[model samples]
Target: MAYFSKHYHNPGTEPGTLVAKSDLGRPVTIHLIDYTEDHLEEVRLANAADCREYLERESKTWIQVNGQADPETLRNLGDLFDLHDLALEDVLNTGQRPKLELYDDQLFIIAAMPFYNGDKLDIVQISLFIGKNYLICLCPLDEDPFEPVRKRMRLANNRRFVTRDIDYLLYALLDLVTDSGFPVLEQFGYQLEEMETDLLENPNQRTLARIHGLKRELLVLRRVLWPQRELLTGLMRTEDPLIHANTQVYFRDCHDHSVQIIELLESFREMATSMLDIYLSSISQRTNETMRVLTIIATIFIPLTFVAGVYGMNFQNPDSPWAMPELGWYFGYPMAWGVMIAIAAGLLWFFKRRGWM
Candidate 1:
């Protein structure tokens, strides 16, 4: 539920310098998936040097680094792949916006994978370096959104997946990451529907808070997805040889998915805003009804108070001819009581007829 921004270097730090801000104590894990038309192999590499044979082989290789390794390991990996220092630095610095950069020999891509854990949306950044025959993926955690893609690659009956180039693999990863947002957006849709019902029936402070929280989360989602749409568009439009023509089509599909996510976020935002308005209007209506009842009670008491004040006065010289004769009559008190009763009953009847009681 808290907002997160990218970590920047010190004011005087040189640009494109690698800075290690992650406090990950665990050792880095390098997993390699090397496959060809007729063979497949998966290995846990001991170090960057163990990847030399796979990089030289005539098959498609995918090297997945589980955690942000120590600075030395990252530098060694960068040297092995000839990856630019700036791109490596971006991989270590978390919370980067979704973007795509084309290097002379590799395509660098950063994507945010969003998922719903309990009631909050969690986003994990996945950085990829795609080259002619190999793809390097750097993830912050072991559990990633690409597990399904891995499973599919494992279960394929023919060479359909293994025979493809690395660009297709890049597309698969991007597609998986883009498609992950749908479930999170679906969860939000259900919650917003329930919230709208509550706002109409019985709104309270807690409901308003939830609405605001959802709005903030939606904004975060929007911030993550808008640039992603542009990133996909750029990938599709680029003339880089690393991205094949067929791969551009897949990127187009990913672009469409990003657009859908952005549209959903916008719709949810508008719904949250409407729920807030409904809550306020509900409170105003209740206040008006309460005031109406209080006004009726005060109006009924006005004439009764006047009659009591008139009878409460004292009169001198009661025996005088022009004195107040009713004060000496035996029926005076009863007549006054009768008049008060009549006044109350008449007013009650008038209110009942006007439908104001």
Candidate 2:
């Protein structure tokens, strides 16, 4: 039920300044994967300089930095690749909304990858700098959503990996990230179904809290997804040379996936709202049933109390004309008892006949 927000920046910091927020303690690691039609090389680079030779080669190079690089290292990278300082700053600063920006020979893209960690949704920001021959992906060290993409590229006979442009690789990464929400949404759907069943059988305070918490999580998901759909649309419509026309067609597919995620999120939100109403209604119905039973019991006892009060009333003397005869007669006491019993039985029969019992 707890949510983590973005970290606040120090006041008066200049724009385009790289700041390390979460992964400051972890040293940055660079992994280079270079591939072409007939050759492939994968290695862990010792430093930024090790990437230079591969960058100059004709092969498509994928430079993946696993941690938030320090300002000096980022500056070196910016100089080496001619990346915009602003884009580098965005990469270091986490919790950016999904967006795409075009720079002078590069396409800057920001994306979010969501994963479930024991019922909690954790989102990681992925920033990409896509150039003609090289692609740089910046992510945290905890998890990599693109591991599948890497595995596909390592396949020896995969013609798609060997013959495709770097833009196709970018599309693959984005597609993976976009489709990641399906599993999370499926989890949500299962939880909601369970909640619905519980509400119908035995609604309680805990159920109410869960519904609210789920609603909040769905809101967070929507915030991440809507803009992502727009980002994909923007990528598909852009005229950037780094994103090929063929690759743009693939972006449309990614956009469709985003749309699907958004639709599911909306459905969950509505279901959560309806669950709240149903919970309230269940409570009210229980209250009404209790009240009805108490009312019936009180109505049945009212006349019985009246009969006992009349019989208990005392006269001035037993010999008086009003009470003496009946008080002295032994049969009078029996007759009075019979009358009271008959009255109670008649009342019970009347209630049964009227279906009030």
Candidate 3:
């Protein structure tokens, strides 16, 4: 994942100019699903223009475009569906902040879908165009996150799921995208617990690095999720006809989920920051402990070194009798050893009594 969208045109480029990403080498695939109360048809098409006939039918049409499309394909989709030029441009340029824009007679929405690709977090931008009888979804990635919704639609015996309107379908898709973060959040939660344990017990540089990485990921999640809450609010409050009153209720639920995810991200950020502080404090504390032990050892040797220095300065002549009387004695060597040991033991005892040991 990049810090920003890698797709952009030159400074003087005109508005609504569609530029396909140079790195987008995969071929675009279109999946068409037409359904009603009791009728259903699903097929894959080789071209975006093939959706024209399906759009004319009485049943609802769902055109799922998977992969980054070229300029020609985007133009074909725009001309066929009467999509706004600006909306098409945004679709071509990925990594848009989540938002809802109203075109002449269509409602356009941009949402970010986050998932874990191995140990890395990646986000895909999904652009949706909601029409009276159709919902066109443009997914930047090839994986289908809407498989669960399709499975629900295919269950003929599911009585509780009776809404056949495209608005309901739109709600389902948004809800899926919003809730996809839960699993990712769960993974983060486990990592946090492990890091917290390490931080409290035996923190190291690796633990601090993990905390920083988590904070960065949480920041990215916040960027993706904060606008989604506002987008959901706009959808519920706006009097867009494409989103029916009944569907607004579902959107409200999805908005609640977005808020929940944001709250989780906020808490995780705080925890990461706290873990960093804990790691620093632990390191400082260990350093202080080591310094104290070294200082005590140096303090204990100070008097012992002074005594050894005095005895080493020897004068064996009678003229130096006043300075070297003990050096010539028979027990002088043992006496010096005893004096050094006594001084060292005394200092240790004093330190223990003063609670500095």
Candidate 4:
């Protein structure tokens, strides 16, 4: 896994070097939100350069790009902002854990957005470059999952992203990232119920494997998410002028989000462990039933085998009184069969009354 971790950077020898992950899909799609306290403009840019004019001026600008497909365009954006080399590298490296770094003049944040609303567990990597007056976010996917945040920005009275300091924009984005996890956890809860159903109705090795796989995915998510608690904690406690004093309260909310996520994860782990126990208990119950039936059958057969053995013994003649004289009786076979049936019936009735049949 060091290989994957090193994919974030090629060690700490240089500040701004290009070690972009080779597997990045393509150059990103660009969207722009140029807003002031009173006005807002949302548009899809044909080029990432279209926002340069707004960035040059003194208005709140947001140039959000989805996915990191084109390395050249990312490099160019880094150049346009005079981004620190390390910050540029962070933009291209898609696998880093959630982090917050205050570089030369920018607050570069790389965080994973957890999404489980859909079929699979989705984690979108979002790298934000927050400058003095502009905010540029590089999303790891082509789709925009921040429409709710965007909708909030459009409201006339609550255009906080436009009127507030760059820190508020960062908070909104991180809030979006952390908020997404709660829904994913909800979806996981649903899937876990499905797992339990399959376990109860008809347990199988395949179901067990799925349970293990899902637990492992949750574990991986836990590894990525718990550190974000510290990240938010650090941001809230720092005295950085870039982050306004009032912003700590918002960061506290984000910290609470992380706590909720951690608690949910712990709950899921406990449920999974309980599920395993339920599975084992079911198997033990089934095995015990089978053994009881077998023991009852053997008990019923023991006396019958003894009676047959006595009749099977060979004895020489009329002088041997211990011999089975019933063999010469007029209706010996019918009498023996009637006796056997009566014994069997009596044993069956006794077992039935005992609730062991």
Candidate 5:
């Protein structure tokens, strides 16, 4: 997977400054959904200024901005919604840690949404501005993950969306963001299981590399998921009237999901560590087996070498009694071969009986 680079202004730049970034080349696309219990109107806007007329309506409104917008568009949106300058800057500069900020006019939330792009994990920064009768979402990525929520709102018979206020909508979005990590975690689960199998059968350098790679991915997942639990807790504990009591219950469920994700990450990390240990043990065991076999072969050949050395000294003096008599025997060459074979056979039997083979 490719790494995600953080985008930020210069160190001395103003907090509210909205700088145009070259990395963000996608044109901004704005989609508006305004609805009541029995009415719904969906439209695509060419300019952020067009949202002013819908914001003035009595019905609840949801504005979704996909990709990066120009400075003029961002300023127009900030003026229309009274968005804090610092919050706008954050929206412009992505890669922010998930957090919750209580602004004077709205409840601001920053969340990381995780998804897989063809077997690789990718995260997009999603910023939400929750007002009394409206919800604004800004996503820096091109993919839109909120289509399911939009589809549900279009259904006429679904009371969950029909009977709820903007707060419930905010909860829905939060719940989606919290649960997005499951699929990514599921992919990790499959990879870890395969690694475990390979570790058991026969581990090599590639197995070790796979283990290290998985550990790094898990670390990234943990960084993205750990703060989310606290973010959800902050949302639930806030006394702001923006979030309803009934909707807080849903937020609690979302918090539980975050805790579950974190626990899974910890379990995966432990498994990755243990897999590395298993790989090392396998390599050590193979080396020991090889050394034992080599030692046995050398031990068997030692006595054979001594016999050959004694017979090779051709001291065949007829006057000396102990001058290597085997050298003078008629069957001297065959006799030497028989002696070496016997010695090898005896050694093999001894080793087998001693359970050292």
Candidate 6:
């Protein structure tokens, strides 16, 4: 689970107030992209305030804050950039579900990017603020996964990010964040399809746990991604002129992307549900087989036990009333043994005839 901030404030609350949580990740390095249709400069920054002039300029600027371990630095950046208080609050609080907020002169969007931390899927929080001329991005503590987007931004042919306003930059970032989930879900779907074979052959404790774990991961993925769909929906329908008419076309593309992700999620959810049923049926079938074997054994033994009990009884001699005198005969024991063998053979023949084995 992502470390949720317990004291995190509400969405509309005052922004600069601190939310306390011990598991906050380490500080992230800042990457600066100062670009326009005519010029381009990509550089690293020791201080976030170095781009003040760029943010104030007419060209598009992007300042990506990599981590949130240092709230003071984030606070300073928020202060310097005139970011809304609630927006900064969202930065420190990892539990904030993905959402889109329109602040005065800026659009605040929160998104969770999915990737494999190891063999497991993990979500990295991405906070984006699309302002007049700059797009500031933030992510969980790690190497920025948006380097590919950055590379594309530098390409001369990609007017989508270069020539359009910052909203397009946001669209590019969100599109990349969303597009990455397809592969993860595709791999998951493949794994689930593979699970069908195993679940049928030998469903066990470990297999059940894996199914549950996968379901949980899907749930969390849905939790983070569903709202992003709505966010994109809002962006598509937004009347803010900050989103240029040309740019709304790209936003419509983004809206279609949201639908794609949501549909994929729904399909994966069905797969998970089906796997659960398969696991249950597999277990039931194994149980039934075990019970059948036990019942067959008991059926084979019932007649044999009855014969032994009848002969093992001690009856008086025939000389007395109600006595069994055959016991006094010299061959009585052998006769009893012979009778038992005959009875056992007859029962075995009957069982074979009935297909009890």
Task: Give the lDDT of residue 245 in candidate 2.
Answer: 85
| Candidate with better TM-score, 2 vs 6 | 2
What is the TM-score (0 to 1) of candidate 5?
0.94
Error in Å for residue 301 of model 2: 2.4
Off by over 4 Å in 3: 159-162
List ranges where model 2 is wrong by over 4 Å. Answer: 1-4, 22-25, 312-316, 319-357
Task: Encode model 2's per-residue lDDT on 110-219: one tens digit a residue.
Answer: 99888898979877788899998999988875445577899999888787867989989989889998998999999999999999999999999999999988889888
Better of 4 and 6 by lDDT: 4
Winner by TM-score between candidate 3 and candidate 2: 3
lDDT of 1 at 200: 79
lDDT of 1 by residue, 268-299 (tens): 89988888888889989889889988887778
lDDT of 6 at 216: 83
Tens digit of lDDT per residue, candidate 6, span 217-266? 88888888888888878888888867777777887887787788779888
Per-residue lDDT of model 3, residues 126-230, tens digit only: 999998888899897877778898888788886333455788888889999999989989999999999999988888888888998899889998998999899
lDDT tens digits, residue span 90-111, model 5: 8888888899999775999999
- After superposition, candidate 6 runs with Cα above 4 Å error: 2-15, 19-25, 314-357
User: What stretches of model 5 exceed 4 Å from their correct place?
Assistant: 1-4
TM-score of each model, paired residue for residue: 0.91, 0.89, 0.96, 0.86, 0.94, 0.87
Model 6 Cα shift for residue 334 (angstroms):
6.3
lDDT of each: 0.84, 0.84, 0.87, 0.79, 0.88, 0.78
Q: Which candidate is the best by lDDT?
A: 5
Candidate with more favorable, higher TM-score: 1 or 3: 3
Candidate number with the higher lDDT (3 or 4): 3
